[model samples]
Target chain A: MSQKIEFENILRRIEEISENSKKIYGAPLIIDPKTGVATWYDQREIKIRFLISIEKIKRFFEALSRGKILATKCVNTGEIMFPPQINCPRDPKNQIEWVEIPNEGELVTWTIIKVKPYSFSHHDDYIVGIAKISNLNINILAWVKCKDPNKLRPGLRVRLNIVKREPENYLIYQLEPLEEC
Target chain B: MRRKVAIVGTGHSIYGVRNDVNLPELAYESIKEAVDEAKIGLDDIDLVVVGNVGGWSSEYLPAIVINEYADLAGKSTFRIEAACATGSAAIKTAVDAIASGEADIALVVGVEKMNESLTPVVVEFIGRSGNYFWEFQNFGLTFPGYYALYATYYMFNYGVKEEDLCLIAVKNHHYASMNPKAHFQRKITVDECMKSRYIAWPLKLYDSCPISDGSASIILASEEIATKITDTPIWIEAIGSASDTSNITRRKDFTGLYAARKAASEAYKKARLDPGEITRHLDLAEVHDCFTIAEIMAYEDLGFAKRGEGVKLIREGQTYIGGLIPVNLSGGLKAKGHPIAATGVGMAVEIARQLWNKIERGRQAPIKNGRGLAHNVGGTGHYAYVTIYSLTKPRG
Candidate 1:
């Protein structure tokens, strides 16, 4: 009962019924099985994939590929920015340096993604969380790896790791409990 | 000096999974009532502000679509979006226009037809609202999941049980049962909320607001025009707005929304009121309750309770009528249905109706001071808008 099918598959079923109804009823309409409400199944679909520019902080991705987490530190104010950026916000003229994010951190908060978005429905119920690396003075948001949900409590010690995400197989950083309780 | 503005007319559509009506049709359901209640023709309006957070809906430009459909095409009009607080943002924009002497009268409409797309698609669209690239692109953060993060931290710090969160939902549903225009008119029990499956851990199906299709409209008038428009004008006492960090990781903490606190303080200051004695000056409040936990946080954010003590307010039923402060008498976003952009305007409409003693029989707050507050938070602390509505005209 916990395992669910992809949302696209369900949408495909709706579209199939919509196609049949169009041929017989002269309009793209489908009745909701639950409420018995008639709705127009749109004929259009949009696929979104953003080409976000990362030219300024390309080094972060470069470090990720090498299994290294990187952050930006303003040389003047000593401000550290995780998910690293180039310019210092407080003083625009201040230069920033890319530095390694400490692997060790404290798990500040976490939540189990029971009902995921359509894009993430294929994966098993996953835990996405935020971790605070005290030494590095940064908090990182990412997938938290754990077998038991109960053990993923706040203030737990965790370590950052770079791994290839499944299905898409792209490089991404994750937080894993240092020692399973 | 800025002129005083008051809510002369208000209209709200029956909220639910409204699959029966299209976008313009849904908006007109409220506009017709508002225009009629204001006793003014559409031509009397100087400007129009439409609040809609549209992505799932079919219309690319809903403001123009609604204007042309409502026969206000030539009027100066523009759409506003502040994630979930779009309605309050629209009202703020119009009030700024009037306060700046830009326009004497304005109409603000908040509408969202989320059910136009399937549930999964709607979830995907909303999940992409915050820090899309850093959060959704990799983390896959749904709206419920985002609040669940706050719920986890809050529960841990406050030693609150999941049952405590369910109480807020139960109370809101009880009120919704009386509100004819609410989404879920049937009251829900704590057991039902507890039994519901988790959308995100710590946040259950019942804890979250449904994807609703609805619209709420409010007509505002400057003091000069307001006097002639209506006798029972709901004055805009004070409005305070603020925003938080886009990324969840960048936020200072997860305990409570700092932005809400700041906005409330600014509003309290402008209103010449104190947060500690909020109940003394106001009869009731309508805080954002997109999720049950959000409502608990709002208790602390709005200074209704001290830190880590908000859960106790719900536990003791202090927020119910005849208690500390009656909240969500309109069923709230929990049961009233949250149509993103429309929720804020609906809050305003609810507060206005509550102040005028026009709410349904059982849920009406006893209007002693003739004042009420509406707390509308956009996204997950992305934006915060606190508006105070009063029956007495504000000091010039």
Candidate 2:
């Protein structure tokens, strides 16, 4: 079972005990066996999901489907913005241009997320990494796919690729390690 | 001329999983203590500033709730959020009020109830604290994951072994063992820390601070009121605050936090202390050690050590008491338990107690300079605050 399911099971057990405690004590109270402290389990539950607006930068998503990653290059300052933004803070004119990110870069840092967040607990352990695009001086954060994590280190050559993430079945960019020169 | 501000009284609750008390109760524990210690009636307080990051807790409006419960309702109050440095931000806000002649007496309280939610949910909330849409949405970077990136690069660049980072955990726990209010009171060995499994790559479970529910409160008064309240008021000498871009990708490099370095420089300049000889000017420091790697980086950012030399300081045990400068003697977030908002205020409480020589034995720093510094960083250096507290009044 996924970690999410395991967590749900524990929550379910707590709810069951809370129900029984309410029937006897007239409150959703459960006493800790170790500390003997009474705690009232909250009955109200809330699940939050944000509907973020990506209207101005929809082209970045459109390019992802076509197997190309895009970043916004400021027309005034020639500065590049990954996770593209239309308005350049440096340029008052809000002038911007879309450019394909250089696929080849060197890995600057990486980490494996073993203790996953609640929303990401369903997925297996994933490696996240940052890569510095050659000559651009801008870094990109993305999932890193590799045969082994031990082989990963700083300065390892990595190439960005657009691929469909599983389960979610959405297009996203990732990094693939390339053999050392 | 700016009026001088001083911390006349301070209070801190035990840091750990406090499922026994609700949010307001936990906050009141410190509030009552502070009010009593300051010997001021609730009506004497002109303002109350609360520092809390509360998405994980049930209380949506903590300031009002805490005020109502503490019998200080109807006082001018507001809440401040600067991630983990919320407490320092709140303290600074009160200090500014008193300095500007806005209020003679102000109460600064920092509290967090992170244990109200499940561990996974709390993880999700903190993970999304940064540039949520850009970094966490697709990347799924947990708090530890963000710091692990820094750990990986710093270790590789500086030839720092995982064992060196474990030594930090070992030292913090050693001091925490002496602190009854700390979370992990049992001392841990380097071998045990090394054996701990990795929560995020290069950062084992022992490297991270535990989720804690606690509160810390301090009473700040203008020079006129401070003298009437207490004879040994801890003077707020300087407070320096700064922020960085939300996106980590925008940073030039991750070796050290630029924001922290900037804040520390401003504080040192204001306090008239030479950064080169910072240890000689301060008796101790309470740096944000949310992660082992963070403490090492803080040493560099705070000018305690040169770049790429923080690891050497830890390796040489220079941060321990009787060394160059004692750091995080109150166990630190690593072992003291990090209660999001309360940590910064807790640092102030620890410093005040240390300066008074009232802290537990074996952990107290020999207070020669009668000055202390608190380096509190919020969200991987997204927000930074450096505050200096001294026994004597600050000179104009």
Candidate 3:
């Protein structure tokens, strides 16, 4: 179960008990069974969802749908930028060109997140890693589908592949070890 | 290029899960002590710079709230945020004010009450501090996950063992046992650290600094006012600040923080101290040990050890007091607790106290050459501040 839902359920149960007590005793207060302290449960609830704009780099997502990994390269300096960029920082006046990243790279490092943040509570423990793609002149971050982190080693060859994320049909990038397990 | 400034008075609140005090109450605890130590009241303060990263906490406008609570509502105040280095950023802002002659006396207060929210919520907020959309939104990288990348690379490339990292926790906790204000006052053995469960692979729970609640404050006075206010004013010898790419992948190396090394070089040049011989110049240092790997990297970045040799220093017990240049004598962020925004200011307070020779025995680094260093890093090397504090005034 998602941690958000688990915590929400606990909050809902408290709300239901408060409503039942108010209906029976004409008070919106509850006494703690453990501490014997009177408490007034808050009724207000707030929900937040941000609106982020990706209009500048929409091509990156469009290419992702077509199973292509794209990176932006500076027209003048020939510097490649990952997480695709709209502007070339080195030469402001120069235009940036979208370039396809080479599928193969070397694995730098990785970590398996055991304790996830609340926003990421829905997912099981996942491994995140950095892979250096020589063609792009940059490192890419992606989920590493590995059975054990101990098997992973620095300088091991890896490749990027597009796959459908489980339980959420969304397409995302992943790293696969090119060398033998 | 401008006039000099010094820390005349400093105050630090106990670092722990401080649920007993609210935001302003916690802030005032340090403010009152700093004011008393400076022998100045609200009227003498010219400007206030507050450092608070407040997403997990209830208060939004902490500067205004603290101003009104401290009875300095009419004074000019501004809040600074640079992730965990908010405290040092706040000090930089106030120092700029004094150097520019805009304010003769400035109050720099850094406060955070992270315990108000649950652990998961705090983790979520900190996790989003990096390139949120690119790194966290899709991948969901926790703070430990980010540092774990360094740990894995450092261990794999440099041949540092997990036991080597555990030694850092053991050393910091040993000092924390003597610190009355530390959160985890009990020391742990290497066996205990190694046995702890993993938060991120290769990085155990003992390897991470806890989500803490605390406050630290420092009163900065211009060169003229500083000499009259206190007999033992710790001069702000030099400050070197630098930043790195927000996305962890953009960095060139994983073994050490590039920003921290750059800032240390800048600070060393300004202080007229050679980076290679930093350990010989200072009596003690308080480097940001947000993680054990970070402390190891700090030794190299601050030039206490050569690259890949930092682990050897810890393994040899060189970082302990009475060893070559004691470090984290106030227990550091590892055991003293890393209260986010308050951590950098806490480092400044601890170093100032060390120079003043006012800290408790057993933990105090014997003062010689009248110098100290504080290396505070924000985020995963997103921002780095290397500040040198000295008893002798800066010639420049």
Clashes of each: 0, 0, 0
Ranking by TM-score: 2, 1, 3
Q: By DockQ, highest first, what's the ranking?
A: 2, 1, 3
Off by over 4 Å in 3: A1-43, A179-181
- Which one wins by lDDT: 1 or 3? 1
Give the alpha carbon lDDT tens digit for every residue of B293-359 in model 2.
9999999999999999999999999999988889999999999999999999999999999998989
C-alpha DockQ of every model: 0.81, 0.88, 0.63
Q: Candidate 2 recovers what fraction of true contacts?
A: 0.88
Q: Evaluate residue A149 in candidate 3 and report its C-alpha lDDT on the 0 to 100 scale.
A: 65
Those runs of model 2 whose alpha carbons end farther than 4 Å from true positions after fitting are: none
**Per-model CA lDDT versus the true structure:** 0.91, 0.93, 0.90
DockQ score of candidate 3? 0.63
The collision pairs in model 1 are none
| Clash pairs for candidate 2 | none
Deviation in angstroms for B262 in model 2? Answer: 0.6
